[model samples]
Target: MKSSLTTIAKHPSISLLKSCTTMKELKQIHAQLVVKGILNHPHLQGQFVATIALHNPTNLNYANQILHHQCHHPTLFTLNSMIRAYSKSTTPHKSFHFYSKILHFNNLSPDHYTFNFLVRTCAQLHVHVTGVSVHCALIKHGFEHDPHVQTGLIFMYAELGCLNSCHGVFEGVVEPDLVSRTAMLHAYAKCGDIEFARKMFDEMPQRDFIAWNAMITGYAQCGRSRDALSMFHLMQMAGVKINEVSMVLVLTACTHLGALDQGRWAHAYVERYKLRMTVTLGTALIDMYAKCGSIDKAMEVFWGMKEKNVYTWSSAIGGLAMNGLGEESLDLFNSMKQDGVKPNEVTFISVLKGCSVVGLVEEGRKHFHSMRTLYGIDPQLEHYGLMVDMYGRAARLEEALIFINSMPIKPHVGAWSALLHACRMHKNKELGELALEKIVELEDKNDGAYVLLSNIYADYMNWEKVSSLRQTMKAKGVKKLPGCSVIEVDGEVHEFFVGDKSHPRYDEIELKLEEIFRCLRLSGYVANTSPVLFDIEEEEKEDALGKHSEKVAVAFGLITLKGVPIRVVMNLRICWDCHNVAKMISKIYDTEIIIRDRSRFHHFKKGDCSCKGYW
Candidate 1:
């Protein structure tokens, strides 16, 4: 090794360094270089330090030791190598310490890479104080105009929530390139300024895939799912190919919109393009199909994957739970643990929900306790809400109230609603009133609470209180959310509001609905008009119950759909009358009727409901 060091000059030394894959091999070659005085070569030393520090990060300490003990004075290249490595190091504070050494010992000024790495580190750490100092130093060195340095500055300031400074740095650039513009787009999205992100995306001369995905994701992140889907269509029309990132964003939008057709199209694109399947894309696809009523397909994709992460299991489990397959969801969760995948918060959300759906009170209680005691995760509001709902649905009203009172965090509206609605179900007027009082204290204008209370009053023949509550609701302008249902027919969604005879085919729809009503009566089915909380005439009440949005959508589906199941998405909980009607219609038409309401999924088939009167 010593004889060979003399023949190995700088260029051959690089070749040796490239060939040396392990730290042990590099150390042996480095020892020979030191013995032959090769360590004094500036370029050779930089190459050696970079190999250990940058390429192989775990050996950064060894690289730092070599830089500290080097016999020759540190050159800019050598200093930058150490600084660059430390920038990405877990201990990024060490990068600043090395920079201080460069300034004090070698009198070498920091280069562009030094600032770039430090600024990114600051962004990662969210250390706004250090980021500001780095920005000041860049300005002092007159490198603020450097495209790469300015890009880092933009990212740092954006992450730090210093949008004004971020924009100032961006606008201050002489002529920003693609990297710079893309950073700005990501920054704007992070800052919750989707409008600004779209502006930047539109103004950019050359739109890359990153830019396209950033804009689409920005819209989705801001709850503008429609805009995100529209942007995706425009991207495809522009001949920009869709990748995994883009597909995930588009699927999210489709999930929010319940656009089953669009989701199917995205899945087809993935298969056609042979895109590499990642956990994120797989999870997104699973969630999309699950929300779109394609649980079978979601599971098919789930089982075909070779790799599974926590999110993968969570999506599959949650998808099953959402589709009213509670037992299957819990089974999949057990499978996840058997496969050595740890459950996350989202995983338990589905687990608890499955327990609630299937009335597994003991299992739900055990897992709820395990959340904190076993996994060391505190139960969040959503978890508590699910528990309250689980107990309420199980007719354990006392336990539900106890759970609400014992909540570490203040109970949300959904939790109270679950308890109050349960009170109504069990005819527990006292607890129902108590839950409504707390709800009113939390939010004064909650109309749902008033409606639930009125129903409770009406149930027990307390007409005086019901009337009083109705007057109060009118005085406070508490309007009930009008019930609406959407059914997708031939790739287009048709919506029907309660008592809405405004559809173009309203004549045909009404005629079919009447025919079905006659058939339902002939089957010895009676309309349960008990859900009409309002104190109206019996005939008017029956007519209103008959014209519910879901009933109309079902009638529409029977007339339009040939053999496929009728799937309806509703904006509110299914009323008792509507639920009964759906079961009867499913039997009468001899077809499956699936309705997803605000609370849970109801699959009516052959005069039986998946909810089993539990919902």
Candidate 2:
């Protein structure tokens, strides 16, 4: 025991052995030394107990023995070690108590490392007051100029959402290094202040890939996809090579832009650049292709990746489900389980989406229950909403209502919206009224909910209720959101809205759509013209229904894309008449049409919709 203590005192890396990072190995060594009667050595004992406390399964009894039996005032190294150990302990409050005791111990001075550790501990515990106090102390102790201390301060204030304090710390540093600057940039970006983050990036003498990534990510998060892509182009122009982090951000931009051409360019760029096969970058690529309306391309990328993780499967499954391949998604989930890839919360979200699409009531119920039973994951509110939506879509209104009523948390507008849509489908006025009441309570400004309820009343031929609802909407000044759709052709996005004649080619577009409708009428495509919100003559109603936003967009896509398969993406649900017309358009034009509506994907191929007359 005495010889080991002497050996440790002379060794510089002895503390490394005591670090929690090496706890398991250290425990084995401790066992060996204990057999040789070395656990009683005072110096080694303090170090050993401190190491154990820092690690999991803290050894409090052994820690107390060394604190009491050791010298009257422990060494600075010993005190710092104990402080770090306690800070990471289950009782973090005890860490500050130990810090207070450090001042009482003579011959010990807290170093920069000690302050940095204290700041990180405060951040982890979310003790903002204590963290601020530590920041003031660092300045008082003339340690504010230290780069490591400044970096820690920036991270702490950022975590607390105190951007002003973070900026002050960044400016006060004697000479900010790259690490400190990067931390400051990240601080601003994370706090939702991307403008300030870009300012910092522009002011830097040189920007590393990390700094570039931070700004790109910030722009992507703020939904400025154009700016993010522009920055990517600027980085290349400035001779900064794109790496995995940069690629991920750019892929996210493509998803938002629906820039399939740009995404394909990026895919080719990745192969040319030969960035290492990282899971994160691969997952981002899969997600990008999926969202850009290329499910087959997404699957190709998913299968090509050698190292597939939970996120990889989740992304591919989510893409398949979103593309109306619900059964395929569930099959992939089962295969993932067989391959021993444990599904995460995100994976469950994809699975739930599949259930919602296919109306798989039993499978949905089983997976929802397994979230708690098999995986021990407590269901979140989002999961509850999805479950309710699944049951509602299946027309199992009783189960859906029971689930809604029994939610541990208050249901959101989405849950109630699901019930309202179900009510519209099943013509259940009682449930519809109940859902409308809840919807108003949840969101008074929900114009869509009001419109849906009014439509329901109209469907029931309840003219008085429909008129009353419209009067209320007008009195409250609640304006309904206009449904819109967009189609991209030849590098330009052409948008359309109901009864809109804003396009330069409106006359030609209208004639083309009418011509398509004639063919549809011949092919048994009856006009289900009930969705139009108007009180007008029969001829006007037909005209209004024929000029729906999606039809305009599809007509534009067909004229521009010619004989090629056209994909039109809408920001709202596709009305029944539009769905039927899309089918007939595909058959008459001998072209495939893919539409992504609010509910799910619809692939109209050769007079057949992939939804199988279900959705």
Candidate 3:
């Protein structure tokens, strides 16, 4: 018996099975094992099961059949292998079937590996009760203190949004190792407790790439783009090996800040390190370039990619729309269909947005109906809002109102807000007032509605109504969101707020602004201060408009960054006055000025805007 075991262990079939690259090779080895009558041996059976179940192109059903039918006395290792494989598979619930088998086997018992995989399966399932039951099973099986098991529990609870449970599991460890500590940090970060995550990160004796990534991704996901970029800078200074994950996170930060220079550096770094341009990384590059006001580069990246997914197509399409190339966006949507990529809900949003920007009312309606008829995708609230915006922007207020009243679902704030914006653009005070009334009824604290209505009133020189709305806002404690703009120079982001004077070079920036306005005035630029809600003198309104956040950031850019385009990212929509000023500045200075506002990108060059006043 011992000699037969030794022969089976050293069999040529076993060696071939270990290195087999394809299912055919594996089956050939399996046939040889059966031909030698060594397949019935428990050790050989376990090895065969492991190889088949754990292979990259795994045959779990076949391995399961062999284990249950061929191996009469399967070992715990064989059962655990099945459990671990199924844990990562799409059918994670199948892992519980093998766990039950382990419990049924009188001679075999589950160990740390079984529980670790089981905990991960629970996380994948995202069932809180099942995760708790698994935790109890881990304790009953005497693996509650195992570091790997504990780490899995932390992750499981984090996925279930049970932050306290994760903390409890971490605190129960006698002396947590690096893996457990990192898991806790990830839990905090994943649960949106970034402050605690950062504190824990700082207190750690050592930090790895995973910990750094968790922190940076947490910041990015939470809309703390500045902090995300700052952390990326620190990660570089610490000599941590940058990977594709790091690049993607930093690119997201750059996208939010419109930090084109930093985004360019990240793209160059990926090339310098020869990192494989994965579909996700390629998509991020396209999005960053698009949002940073570089549509041509975005297109270049989109075309250069060898592999493209639906998300990649959507990003490219959305980038074109955001850059105010609505016709090009619609053209690409057709190309996407030709490439056999079915559009999802997000794809339709971009399509409708493209229609809205270019006033393609007929095309927007055709695509909007196609979403349901062709793709079986129901129009969501955002789609409805876009339809309203399309008609509203085209000055078809009656059609927009008809569409809003026809919505199957209750109209949301976005629909009314779109109508209000259109009213403000066309100076339709009656419709603007009606939209504001509906918006206020839906959301009394919507500062944007109040601000928009005030602007519409100010447009008609209705000072009493504007002052009344302001008083109502003050009474209701609805404060307008202050405008903020960010610009990057020398790879560092500079943020400016409305009337901001905190920058060290504020005096220099002020002087530069004076010079810029002088040049702009010489070229027939005038401040259109009708949008200002304050009932102040014309000179005071002009001064207030001049102190807007984007102008300050642009002034700083002119003073510090010469021979490069001035890129500004605003937290709100660019006013008419600022937009005109940017166009004149671009031509007078013979430079480009790109501003990404709340809605879309405005590329100012040679006294013209890419949006052509559409946005």
Most lDDT-accurate candidate: 3
Tell me the lDDT of model 1 at 76.
Answer: 74
Residue pairs with clashing backbones, model 3: none
Error of 1 at 221 (Å): 3.2
Please give the range of 10 consecutive residues that has the lowest summed lDDT in model 1: 2-11
What lDDT tens digits, residue by residue, belong to model 3 across residues 1-615? 999789878877777787888778887888887787778788888888888888852588888787777787778888888888888886899999989988898988889999999998999999989999999988988998898899999999999999999999999999977788889988998898999999999999988898898889989988999999999989999999889999999999999999999999999999999987999999999999999999999999999999898899889888888888889999999999999888999999999988888999999999999999999999999999999999999999999999999999999999999999989888899999999999999999999899888888777777898889988988899987899999999999999989769999999988988899888888787788866777689889888899999999999988888999899999999988899999888888888999999999898999999888766
What is the descending TM-score order? 3, 2, 1
Q: Give model 1 RMSD, 1 decimal.
A: 5.5
Candidate 1 lDDT over residue span 1-615, tens digit each: 554544544456567777777888888877877887878776667777777778677788988888878745877777777777777776777877767766776467887877787787788777888888878887887788888888888888988988888889988888888888998898888899988888889999999888899899889988787789889889999999779999999889877766788889889999899998998999899988888778899999899888889898998998898888889999998899899887878889999988988888999999999988878778888999899989998999999999998888889887998899889888899999999988888888998799888888878878788888888878888888888888878766687998778899999999998999999999997876666656698778778888889999999999999778998888888887899999988888899988888777788999989888877
| Candidate 1 runs further than 4 Å off | 1-146, 149-166, 182-202, 495-511, 521-538, 542-547
In candidate 3, which residue ranges exceed 4 Å CA deviation? 1-130, 137-143, 369-379, 522-524
Q: Over the stretch 249-289, how does candidate 2's per-residue lDDT look in tens digits?
A: 88888777666677777777888989766998899999988
lDDT of 2: 0.79
Worst 10 residues of 3 by lDDT: 56-65
Winner by lDDT between candidate 2 and candidate 1: 1
